[model samples]
Target: MSDNTKAYLHIYCAKNIIVDEQKFSELEHIKGDDLEDVIKVSTDKHIVTANYDLPSNSVFNSRIKAKDISISCPLLEAGKHYVISIYEVTPEVAATEESTFMDYVHAEEIEKGYSICLYRKK
Candidate 1:
């Protein structure tokens, strides 16, 4: 992977995440005792294919019409938000057929029934 190559980090487990500063600022005004706290997970180190669109009832989705939602994955929970990050991975990592995150996850799954990944982007 060249320095120009980039990778996308998708946190599948997070129920709520603020990807941008603008959106994160809004959390302060939300009134509720059960406000979700943002947990900064460390990056163990982390596709643009089809132009698929999300269903009309997709979560954290803008009411727009376009074919850019092709990368949608099944949300583990409804009405929850997950963070999507994009960054460059090391050349060694990017060269792998599997993502660095997946590589770590798969190894953990074999060693332990459950695994925890805390990856913070640099």
Candidate 2:
């Protein structure tokens, strides 16, 4: 894909394993100490999409919006501890694994018209 290509990803992060449990519900269950810690970090739509080519060592700050709540992402860095989940919205190819994050986790088609792929940073 070209550099201008924009891919839609439902980005999420948490202080604990609650986010992982939701992403990989079919896998072996993961237990977390507190369910309240599983706060939705941020969605791709909230951030600036123009800065897509972030350097490997670059660090930036952003906000996380969950429902009526909005807060900082806390020293957000590129290619750090993050799990990216991609939803196939169309049959046409828009982005690839190389242009995005790393570590292919799992992918599944929940129904005939819906599909999702998960990737974890290495």
Candidate 3:
């Protein structure tokens, strides 16, 4: 069995590119008009399992500790751009690109594992 740990996964949708701290801080308090800027889609606890042998073609395969980190979030939808933050405190806006969702994968044997995928918006 793969070793797994409980972690908080914060999902954010970027409306526009965050260049400065002021614009980045807006992600914290989402207002009416600001809603179009950045939206905190989902925040939840999940079991993150390490995949030692990840597919070579996978985009996240090169990322440290990202290759096999699997979690289930039904709220995720296909074809939508998202930023997946895996940290206790507020995640820095800079990790947005590196932490982007790859895409969804079906895991039938892994308990509680759902379609896992991550992708960036063009």
TM-score of each: 0.20, 0.26, 0.19
Instruction: Give the alpha carbon lDDT tens digit for every residue of 1-122 in model 3.
Output: 11122211223322232322223444343333324333333333223333322223347666432233444433433334333323222122222325233432222222122223332343
Worst 10 residues of 2 by lDDT: 46-55
Give me the overall lDDT of model 3.
0.32
Candidate 2's residue-wise lDDT over 38-98, tens digit each?
1233333222111011112225644432221122122233323333332443212222345
How much lDDT does each candidate structure score? 0.28, 0.31, 0.32
The total of clashing pairs for model 1 equals 6
**lDDT string, candidate 1, 1-122, tens digits:** 11112223334322333433223344332222334234222222211112222234447866843232112222122222233322233323433435433332111110122222323233
lDDT of 1 at 8: 30
Q: Which wins on lDDT, candidate 1 or candidate 2?
A: 2
Angstrom error at residue 41, model 2 = 15
- The candidate maximizing TM-score is 2
